[model samples]
Target: MTRSHALFILMLSTALPQMALAQAPEAQSGDADILVTGRAEKLYRATDTEIGRGSSDPLDIPQSVQVITSELIRDQGARDITDLYRNVAGISASQYATVTYRGFRQDGNFYDGMRGDPFQGFAVPSLFSIERVEFLKGPVGMLYGASAPGGMINYVTKKPQDEFAASLRGIVGNYDRYGGSGEITGPIDKDGVLTGRAGAFYEHVGTVQRNSDTSSLVLDGGLGVKIGPDTKMTVQLTRYEQDLAGRLRGIPIDEDGNFLADRTWNHLEPSDYMKLNGTVAQMRLDHKASDALSFNLSSRWFRYKEDQDYHEPRPVSDTDGDGVPDTVTREFRRQHRNIEGVTIAANMIAHVQTGPLRHTIAAGGDWYWQQSLFDGVSTRAGVPPLSLTNPVYGLVPVGGYDLSNGSVERSDTRSHRYGLYAQDQIDWGRFTLVGGVRQDWFDDADPVTNTAKTSGKRTSWRTGGIYKPMQRVSLYASYSQSFEPQDPSRQSASVGGPFAPVASRQVEIGAKGELLGGKLQPTIALYRIVRRGIVQVDPDLAPINGVDQMSPIGEVTSKGIELTLAADITRDWVLTANYAYNDARITDSAPGAAIDNSVGGRFPNAPDHQAGFWTRYQIPAIDAAFAFGGQYVSGQLARSGAHMKGFTVFDGSVTKGLGFADLMIRIENIFDKTYATSAFDARRGAFVGRARTVFAELRVNL
Candidate 1:
């Protein structure tokens, strides 16, 4: 271990006893529930959250954190994270397999409070086993080291219950879609010291595109044991597999942002396919050592593998001496990857008193190890160009191509990360102060080359305050910093060595409150985030071996305002609404930076304005509920200055409770709106959003 690391550990050991002794003698029990449980009629208010690590109330966090409750997920029939976009402000799904939040791309996915896998190049997790989703926005490095500046999304899984319960559900939808899922939970011991839960789901679905279908399966199980009066341990396991036949590449668009072909067009061969398989196992222990202190330890192991063989269409070119492009070519490619990782974390929460102020202090240390192998090959020959006006299918020969002998590239990489952090929330009368600091060390190596390519260390900090002027209102402001290491593979050879980590900082002010006799809740926030040290091609250095040299560029900034509202308007009615306006651009760049010419350009895929609203009503006499919602996104710029038109889509659902089951019918894109959900480049192509679709589901509980 390095000297710096040893010193850090020594300091942490010395502070532990001081923190415990500082606790108040009259402190309350430390058994406060850590999970957000129990369903609410309205979607607005959440009393507790795990985002703060210590389950602090949202109003006291001084940052923007949105919770998509299980109730809301069911009402919207959400199948994946993307389906929840209508409920979250300032977030958009991008074409490059990542989500754009506040103009920054985020590819991190977390399960519970620990890091999971990279979101890109993988299928979205099933919602059947997820209890809820939490989105924490802004620079959160102090709590979660080495993360995107925009934010992170966390999935909280369901736990075993002491009482017996079981549920079964079946679903059928348009486009030849069908699925079934079941879950059961109960006690395994008469004394209730042991409990178990299990869930499984299978789905076969067809897409609007021709010859494209998907099959998926997921299995989850967990066991919980109460070892002592104040201690509990749980073990969980999950397995998931998915296969997609004839996956579709996006359709190309014209200079005017008009689709060159039909929205449902499939550019890939019918034989192309993609598959994903993964397994995860986790163990957790929670113990309340004393009335003023608690400890939690969790460890997880994950293995994931994926394979894909597909074809993509190239841009149209004018071959007939005409201004308009009339021909396009297709290229075939294949790729395979395997990833494995392990993570462990230990944390302690202490309720202490300093003078006349009360404090909740949390300290934690985490470690992660990951290894990955990737192989790829692509055909050198391209398919003949086809006519733009009249396309021919099955014209290209596929039997003669040899994939094994094609151009091949393979690599193996391993990485390790360690982090230690501490945070304290201090309360004095009507004012609350929050402060935190974290240090992280990271290393990456390539086994094929037998070299350690990169290593680094960094520290992050955050400070904020909250003031409650009334019983129902909180006003707060905060500033935080984050850092993320740049992959050496992406850096130019001219850099000579590993590039410096990208740094980001944010300043935010927000207000949250309850109104109308606790029936209504609202939140508003204004924030600015700035990112520096982004890698860019060095204009002065010409390409060597077809690769350009790179250097650190200036800064990019995203500033925005957001508003959210949730209300239980009446005994039978609930409503949720949100709106956001974001302005993101490159503020500065080096003279020789590749993006220097486009420093003033807006960030791609980031819309300037977005708004959405959903409302549901229940009829007690008939035991039925109906919901309707609509979302709007303003025009956005593509990567090459092309403009994408704004669009609005509507959705509706109806549910009726039967004696032993509940029936639900849902329709999305009620008006069959045609729009581009994401784009590659201006001339390359853009993904078409889903057309009007319908689904019917039946759920039974025992």
Candidate 2:
């Protein structure tokens, strides 16, 4: 541990005991249920209202959605997307793990309905300028083209506020880590008609894995104008840069080939390194044509670049008699990737309200274009007979072929998508009905790297109903669909070797209710997803590990249940919890396949059980709050048949407000427990997991 990190932890521990003892009594119950314009809150009224960030009615969205609020982030001591996932049910993070919904891994991510996939392993979003994160479970292809059938995640950026407010915060944490964020939002003109907001944040973080660290900076700004009585316009831009210094860890399986023990902590030496840098920007406009009609349009552009190089130890051969094995060899590889994209969307909503009936209709269209280029170079040095004992580790640089040797390849791909969707919601007394349909056209064009192209059309629809059983009670159920064309980069045989496009579909049903004095909101959902024809290079033709190149040839099915609960049991106490159960299996297999897996066997890295919960208490007299929470995931199988046991982790945080400033402190892995987020290389017992850590901050708000 560095001297600075040691000191920070020491100071925090020294002050906590005394502060807690001197704090005033906790606030009474019922005070925390204040009605607020939260993102999740807006989702429920999707059909009737134009969603700027999120809807006013979250429940009526027809999908299993979970909102990670700004408050949850603060209370959980979260610093990044990885941290956020720790307490979000149904989500798991393994370096080799794929995005999953209902136990099935999905594709990348989305931001405000736009694509947010990282080409060369770089898709973590900064939370410093976020208001909330919405996790929409199930297929979202209808709304977001090329999305994974598993699900989609949307990050809600903070917007301009009507009130004048500014805050600055700084923190020092364990492992020589420190960071801070500053934010300002207010009206630029009187009458609160025009508002603006700007925020900046920076962080220097360290990991338990030696030589693994991250330094990041972000700047966000936005302007909102109330053009007229019913029209509004907003423009937003964000820039971010991050430096990563870390040893990438792969998956690890036991001798029998299952995920290793849940609590195992085995990290490799710091001999590998990877880093990335990128930026994203967006703009939006909203206008109300009349008292019953409104329109929205938004556009986004993103650019990313990364530099990566790593060392690989391989076997070497020795001819002469040397006491030391035979020969030493090493391999080095460097990859550079550039990705850019733009998206445009326009939507309109019309509402009709009368004595006994209320109706809202919405229709919209969206378009997106994304292009990416990847270049790589690999070099090897040492004696060649290739023996296991004569390994490659210590070696000097040597002359190696450049791109001409086919060791390096460059490829660019463009994916374009257009979609039209319509939805309607009708309300009659205490009953409400909602339904929607979407048509999408996806086009992928690539002429440079061999010949690769795919054109596909998909249609998805959804319907649901909500009934208010009583003044404080309600029931809701919904069904929805999703789809995705073949990945643009998938390889093929005719022009190249043998790979084709893959497609997927999904079905869902769910219900939610609020009871116990309008304080507790809970939901239960069940869904099934089907995927057919996944493209792959023929292991024999392309010889990817001696396997022939192949086209999409099999079908997989995944089904699961989800439950969530969020409530303020009392004024001083609030609790949030969620659980997910998944059953994913492969229903079909390719002929002459190398591996014959079972239909009921668990999917790779998809845990069958997942849950998370958080609770907080407010001490009003002292202006302080305390929170405790964590997540649990069941064990999952490694790709190579290894079983990784399930594990549970915990975290906590506390904040106190002074006259003009507030101090916030948080501890991660409170139990100092050791566990692996992911691992690979069954031959070696190396796993990657974070150790215990602490963070503290001082903030000034005006």
**Best candidate (score: TM-score):** 1
Q: Write down the lDDT of every candidate, Cα atoms only.
A: 0.79, 0.64
- Reference-based TM-score of each model: 0.90, 0.82
Q: Rate residue 671 of model 2 by lDDT.
A: 91
lDDT (10s digit) by residue, model 2, range 470-555: 75444666666666666555544342433333566666666766666546677787778887776533344554554445656667
Please provide the root mean square deviation of candidate 1 (C-alpha atoms, Å). Answer: 10.0
Error of 2 at 395 (Å): 6.4
Which candidate comes out best when scored by lDDT?
Answer: 1
Off by over 4 Å in 2: 1-56, 96-98, 116-120, 191-193, 251-253, 256-273, 312-330, 353-357, 382-406, 471-474, 488-503, 535-553, 591-601, 680-687
- The lDDT of model 2 is 0.64
Query: Once model 2 is optimally superposed onto the true structure by TM-score, how far is the C-alpha of residue 198 displaced, in angstroms?
Result: 1.7
